[model samples]
Target: MSNVSYYTAEGLKKLKEELNQLRDVERPLASQAIAEARDKGDLSENAEYDAAKEAQGLLELKIAKLEETLANARLIDESQLDTSKVLVLSTVKLRNKQNGMEMKYTLVAESEADLKSGKISVTSPIGKGLLGKKVGDTASISVPNGTLKFEILEITRN
Candidate 1:
């Protein structure tokens, strides 16, 4: 099954850059380390050769996984996004019903989520709860502690 993921233009660019770094820079470094270790002595008795081979295997696995992710990634056009309701890339302003505290968050792909920057994964509990919500809509989300209610104050596309 293809696990397709959506990303903004910037997010997609970052993913591509990371894949390139892994393939171009790290791959060659791993190969060089393995070559140096192989030239030392017998393969069975050499611990350095064994470790280098293991490291190279892990690096190759990482590269393959990244390539697969890039293949399944779809770039989202911010200009074409609808602001009528909450969806991916929507910047939502929420108000906590219990404490009247207000906060803002941008719904993004899982790989692009950064809580410090107010970007949240769409699959997260709060993000799922807020999905498709409109202004003045209340979202009752179940968390580890308890159910927290949030009032959707506004939704906009940035």
Candidate 2:
């Protein structure tokens, strides 16, 4: 069975758009490239044909992966989320217990993780440790560097 993924309404919409782009645009473009390459010369000796075939295979693999992700995705209702604890799609404010540094992040599905936007995957070490924690609660997370502690300052659905 495929692992279920939790996504907010906006996240789900973005996923759907990406899937559509891959199927409607990239797939057709790949097919066209293969056809164009095939017309150039013999299949065995043509480098262009070989390259195009490899590209087509990769594109199809990507499409299949995206389709699987969509099949297992579950759209979460933000309104139904409780602000009392950190969970998927929760925007959390935290303070480093060891160094007093403050940081904020939103927990999202792996597909939606974007460090530039301060969104972290729920499967990540910090995100996993923060889940189910409430404001004023402390979480000790194990990371590649070492174990770090964080104090939750706030949790809100975004």
Query: Per-candidate TM vs. native?
Result: 0.97, 0.93
Off by over 4 Å in 1: none
- Cα lDDT of model 2 by residue, 46-129, tens digit: 999899899999989998998999899999888888999998989999999999999999999988899999999999998899
lDDT of 1 by residue, 82-129 (tens): 887899999999999999999999999999999999999999999999
C-alpha root-mean-square deviation, candidate 2: 1.3
Candidate of highest TM-score = 1
lDDT for every model?
A: 0.94, 0.92
Find the 10 residues in a row with the least total lDDT in model 2. Answer: 7-16
Backbone clash total for model 2 is 0
Per model, state how many residue pairs clash: 0, 0
